[model samples]
Target: MNRILLQLAGLFSALSLSAFGGGKVVLPSMHQAAVGEYHWMTSQQFVDLFSISMAAPGPSMMVVTLVGLKACMPYGTVAAILGALVATFAMFVPSSVLVYFAGNWWDHWKESPWRHAVMDAIMPISTGLILAATWIISKTSIHTVPTAILGVIALLLMLFTKINPVLMMAAAGAISWVFLS
Candidate 1:
């Protein structure tokens, strides 16, 4: 009820603030919170939700909406939608507002040498965060040899080819449905 919605709001809000690199960067912690600390979902469910989110997405962080919905499943669908909306707002609005203001301030300082220096310094950290997120997703996702093969194929396709990502997604799904499963 009220308690669950509040918890969702708090958890997403905290994650929103911490999403320095991107929504993906927060997956590990969000997974721990939803699957571990709150006991709201099993690890398998968390992994499944993430897979679902990536497959059907406006944004990668749509996983938050899935998490929220799953959290309130015992309630009716309306409650579940409310839970999703609340978590989505918590995850997006606060960080967006901060970025908006920060963008304004940053523009004013855009010409400063120190600004470029700061960006250069932070690039490595951002890259590292993204790499860590990749590892986290890989560990959660590559549950079997076939899935790992699919992951490697997808990675190679992305890195070296001009193949459409949607096509890759479909190929992976087809492979999984036909073989991996």
Candidate 2:
């Protein structure tokens, strides 16, 4: 139990801190921790949980909390929540403090060549991580030809159509149950 809690906390903390844009950006890290590193969940399970988390009303950050709960119950949930909070704080506080003190200078530095170079360096790494995550999730999720077709259709729908994802997920799930199963 303690091990589970610690792992949950550590995983959440790592993703939370590493995330540059927001919770969506951390999905790869969360996937890695849960599916790849710890083997706490299968890739399909992780994808399903991600779907459920997105379908829920609150922020995507809640996905970590849900994953923790699924991993080890109440204690793991607490640790996950705390880990996210701590990790967010660790990233936020320093920037906030720096901004508070260096307001104009911070803005100026943001436009500097060095900053641009840093961003260029970071982009590829982030893209690679997201790609790896996509690969992993796809390998785990596309077990059958029908499922693969569903995934492709879902991707196309998400990319080209204006349909809500929750509805698509429901439709896909229903189709899977009725036809694939």
Candidate 3:
């Protein structure tokens, strides 16, 4: 038990340091580690937890708390929580220091061709990850043509309508419980 916890802690810690361009950018790696490598949760579970975390307060990184809780019990939660904190600190501290001291340099670099080239290199990687996460969610949530249609319609409606996302999700849940179940 302790060994697995320690391993998970180390894995998450390393992942934290590797995360770039905020949480979404490194999400695919995190998903791979947690869902594929660790078998801590299913892809659907990750999607559900992500939704729940987003709907709640605080940073979207709260998904780490959910993952930690799911991975073990109190100890797992502690380790995961600490892992998240360490990850955030590891990323933030350097950034904060850089911004504090080298703010103008960073701003100047933004206009450099190298900055554009770096953005170009990273854009596809980030997009691919986001697409993979979407595919994983779709695989679980849209098992049938009707459900797929529902999802598409829900997506379009959210994009076009003023309806609250929380309300839409609730409605979808009710409909699923009624027809799909």
Candidate 4:
């Protein structure tokens, strides 16, 4: 139990620090660590947790709590809760501190030409990271034909239409419940 908590702390702290743009940017790494390296859960379980976290009100990074919970479930409920707390704290605190300091520094450099150049350079990297995350999630989630079609439709709607995403999600859920189930 202690070992699992330690691993959760280590993994989330590292991932939190490396999350460049946001939690989504580190989804691939998180998936790799939780599903591939640690054997905490399967890829499907990770995807399910991701979906749950995204659907929740807070930050999408809350998936770390689910990861930790699943990882320590074999130990007991108390252990699982502890794991969730540990992972969530580790995932938020270090990066938050870094962001606090960096934000201060960024504001201090507001007038610098180098700041603009840095921002420009970061744009592509952030976009690529987000794309990679999207690709990873798509690969894991879009296994069946119905899922594929739904994904494409959702992508098109998101890209080209002004439809509210919550409505889309609700529609998709209804469609899946009616047709896929």
| TM-score for each of the candidates | 0.90, 0.69, 0.70, 0.92
Clashing pairs in 2: none
Query: Residue 2 deviation, candidate 3, in Å?
Result: 4.3
Best by TM-score: 4
Cα lDDT tens digits, model 4, 1-181, are 8888899899899988887677788888889998899899999899989888877778767998999999999999998999999999999999989978889788768889998798798778889999998998888899999999999999999999999776787789899999988
Candidate 4: segments with Cα more than 4 A from true spot = none
Model 3: per-residue lDDT, tens digit, 1-181?
4554565566655655554555555566667777998787888898788778767777765676666656664455566566555444543455456557877688788778998888888788778766876776677667898788789989899899999776787788789899988
TM-score, structure 2 vs. true: 0.69
The global C-alpha lDDT for each of the candidates, from Candidate 1 onward, is 0.86, 0.70, 0.69, 0.88
Best by lDDT: 4
Prediction-by-prediction clash tally: 0, 0, 0, 0
lDDT of 2 by residue, 46-69 (tens): 887776777777765566656765
Ranking by lDDT: 4, 1, 2, 3
| Prediction 4 global C-alpha lDDT | 0.88
For candidate 1, write residues 1-181 as lDDT tens digits. Answer: 8898999999999989978768887887888888889888998899888878877848878999999998888798999899889989999999999988898788779878998788787778778877876787678778788888889889999999999777788778998899755
